[model samples]
Target: MILKYIVERNNKYKTIREVLKNEFKISSRLLTKLRSNKKVLLNGFSTYFDKEINFNDIVEVYLNYEEDNSNIVPNNIPLDIIYEDESFIVINKPAGIAIHPSCLHYDNSLSNGVKYYFDKIGLKKKIRPVNRLDKDTSGLVIFAKNEYIQECLVRQMNSALFYKEYMAIVNGILEQKSGVIDVSIARKENSIIERCVSNDGENAVTLYEVLKSFDNLSLLKCILKTGRTHQIRVHCKFIGHPIIGDTLYGTKSDIISRQALHAYKVKFIHPLYNNTVEFCAPLPDDFRKIIENEI
Candidate 1:
């Protein structure tokens, strides 16, 4: 695959290979291959390895090979089916399962499981998930089975018509029983792995209500006004109430293995049925144990 980047500043610029190696942390050999395949371009013009870059230039990249989506065979993975109709299907995704295939996880994803289920029923086309949950986070998920339903649900997501509620166990007892967290977040170090509250970050809002409190932990019902990557986790950490067991953003806890966050409820209007649909998943066993013991 080819990668392109436009120079935004007039400072000493790096080559395409150098930029990919430094910015994306990709291997040097892969960068060399991408350049050799004429997959890298600068300012809409194909150039050799020694191309000079200027500010406000538009870059285009071409891929030598296409993604082989056919090899994505179905795996007969077990799934907790919450709701299903002609238009869409909802699943209570278990923890420690990735939603889609990525660098870290190639197969054994929730998508693969969904595909396998559809294939078992003799459905050819694949279903597309309307939203995503982190690999370690578990709860309700919706998938559109066709393009018409996909477009409708995507519209609802863009307009915030879909309602999602999450449950999280944080480190400290929040003094405010209910409050709004309005913080702007942006990528840190140009990495998709980390984000931070920044002046130029995108606007994000979250409403949270404390469900229960303990000496050291508090369970919160979190609602997102604007969905952003790591929004809930980042906001909680910003308020000095980081989610328990979130190793990336806060201190890890022995009481919980992964981040103490779960999508508990989701409500949306079904495109084909033209009726409101709602689904909920109970807290995972580990999370329930923490509540039973701690709070």
Candidate 2:
């Protein structure tokens, strides 16, 4: 393992070991190992543990470990692959399926599902998801089959080169036909809850238009301008209309088990072919049924 850190102005006066443990959150044992192995260096020169650091000082620590093959596993899991080529794949993920395994969820995730599919096709490298959807939200998901394609698609996402369209069902009818929700959001607790219009938060934006209106339910087409966790749900709640069935930020309803949101369309430049590619997933049966009966 190679660890790199650049000293910032806030902690310029601390010693290298102090900075590593306090600022960078490195364990003291790890620092001692790096120092003992003489793998701790400043500006390419091996530095002592007590060396005083300054602003802009670059420190590197090299650790010994075998390469990671933990992510490479073969399991025969079902996946709805919409499109696939040499460099990339697009799949329609279903609700109740997580995108990746984390501490809370260790198996039965979309990442594992992708790995299983690749193994079925005899591909070795792990597929990397470009964007993520919440576990309960279903929609089109894109994955890069190789590192080169992964970097390209990641750059596109950071530059907002890709277009994403989502469909949502809110609790009430909007007074306006079309509008934008510009709010800042931040996490409130350790839970998945978030606060909108927060003073100390990052900017989040969502553009929406009403597609149809029922007595108390509204079908909405939403385009995300900035991708923030729980942006759509939080913003909808901020505007006095929360996503129907969103247990986290809205009044619970019987329309759906989870938040009524779906990533319907995605458009981007293909990584391997270098041409524009677009994919879409039709609304899930449950969503359509809710609309048909409510609206």
Candidate 3:
């Protein structure tokens, strides 16, 4: 991949170093690698970092010129890919699949599946997930093809520019049509996986709007203001409308085997393309069954 930059007017940048640092936002590690690889070009020619340039000059940086070797073992597990490009891929991850390799789940994971797909397509790049969803939560998940794209997307995720929306089925009908849950959450004592609302925990915020109501359940649209571990689960419990089948925060249900939560949408600015991009994943079959009165 080649990144092209054209100097424009009203600029304070005078040197390549300034342009790279301020305009391009290149990391020191990647800059060092670029220097070693001799891939940085100015006006279609190799140039030093200190070389001077004028307005409208073109600067190009080549990336992924060599094949990358990753340790993640490839497997033939199937993937539901929604979108794919040279820089990234969006997958509709199903329930019961881990994002990456863990002690209990090593081969039959999304990472391994991505490795297999990339290998089959003859693309050599490491698997890098921009965000994660719980094992039981199904939704859209983004993965970058290279280190530069991964770092750029991660920076956006840490900022206010990235957005994630979820759809969930809660246990009870909410009194208020919509509301915000502003609370602090901390891991429960002596438990590695449980989280609860506490004054001594990190700040968490969630916005929710009731979409539809059923006999004993309510479908809700949830938007996360801050990403926390099991945030939606804990916040829904805090609001007295825990998600259905959430064994950790709420009681189990027969309608769904796992928590009835889905990451429905994601929106972000393209780090390299300079355009806004959004993706949506349709509700899984189990969620549709409950909403359509099939369960």
Candidate 4:
């Protein structure tokens, strides 16, 4: 992706380096790569970085370059892509698919599938997923197409610019229909994959509202203020309302094959255009069935 910058009256008489660093907020690391790759253009031609420019000076930084992604074995696993742009791709991932390739997942991971899609489209950029969801959690996942874009989006995490919303089905009806859970969470002792609520941990906050109740279960609309490993799961468990099928934090159940959680919405500022955008993932089959059949 080529980021264009027009030097306006207030942004005039600054070097390309200053313009990119101060005005465009380009990281030093990304600037170095752009310089090395001769990707920075001034007035439709390559120019010295330190050269001073005035009003209307057009500066463009090209980031849609190719890279070697052979480390991940591309697989043709099906993907539920929601939106795609020159800067990023958003996917509505189903339950049971790992995000990144691992020793056990190998080529069956979502990254592998994304690699295949990128290759098919002739895009050789590295796979850079901006956010993560657990293997058993269905969610909206954003994958940045370039490193610059990745950095821009990643910086928005846990901030007002990025908003993550989820729908969760948990055991027992909540007494408080709407409330916030402010607690700290840390890695469980001697456990690599488990998280627990503790005083000696990172401050995690979750704002939740009870949306629906059926029998012994309640549907909750959860908004994560601080993103941590298994944050919602750990917080729900701390409040004595763990997700219905979250075996790691709660208990296994036949009502749902995986964790009864879904990242239904994601809102963020588009890095390239600075436009606030939001996307929603439709509830998957199992989640919809439970709500429809149970009610």
Tens digits of per-residue lDDT for model 3, 85-188: 88899999999999989776667889999999999998887788989999899999999987788888888887888999999999888999999999999999
lDDT of 1 at 292: 85
The residue ranges of model 3 lying beyond 4 angstroms of the native Cα positions read 8-11
- 1-295: candidate 1 lDDT, tens digit per residue: 2345667876445665555545434455545655666666777666775565568765555543322335455778999988887678889888899888776566899888887887788666555898888888889888876544566687777778888899999998888999999989999876868889987999999999999997688999999888889999999999999999899899878887899999999888876556888899989898998888843
Q: Is candidate 1 or candidate 4 better by lDDT?
A: 4
Candidate 4: which stretches are off by over 4 Å? none
lDDT of each: 0.79, 0.79, 0.89, 0.90
Error of 2 at 20 (Å): 33
Best by TM-score: 4
Candidate ranking (TM-score, best to worst): 4, 3, 1, 2
lDDT of 4 by residue, 1-295 (tens): 6788888888644699887887777898888888888899999998778989888889988886778999899999899999998889999999999999988657889999999999999999889999999999998999999998898898898476899999999999899999999999999999999989999999999999999998788899999998999999998999999999999998998889999999999999998888998999999988998888753
By lDDT: ranked, best first: 4, 3, 2, 1
> Which ranges in model 2 have alpha carbons more than 4 Å from their true place?
1-69, 189-195
What is the overall TM-score of model 2 with all chains considered together?
Answer: 0.74
Clashing pairs in 1: none
Model 3 is weakest, by summed lDDT over 10 consecutive residues, at 64-73
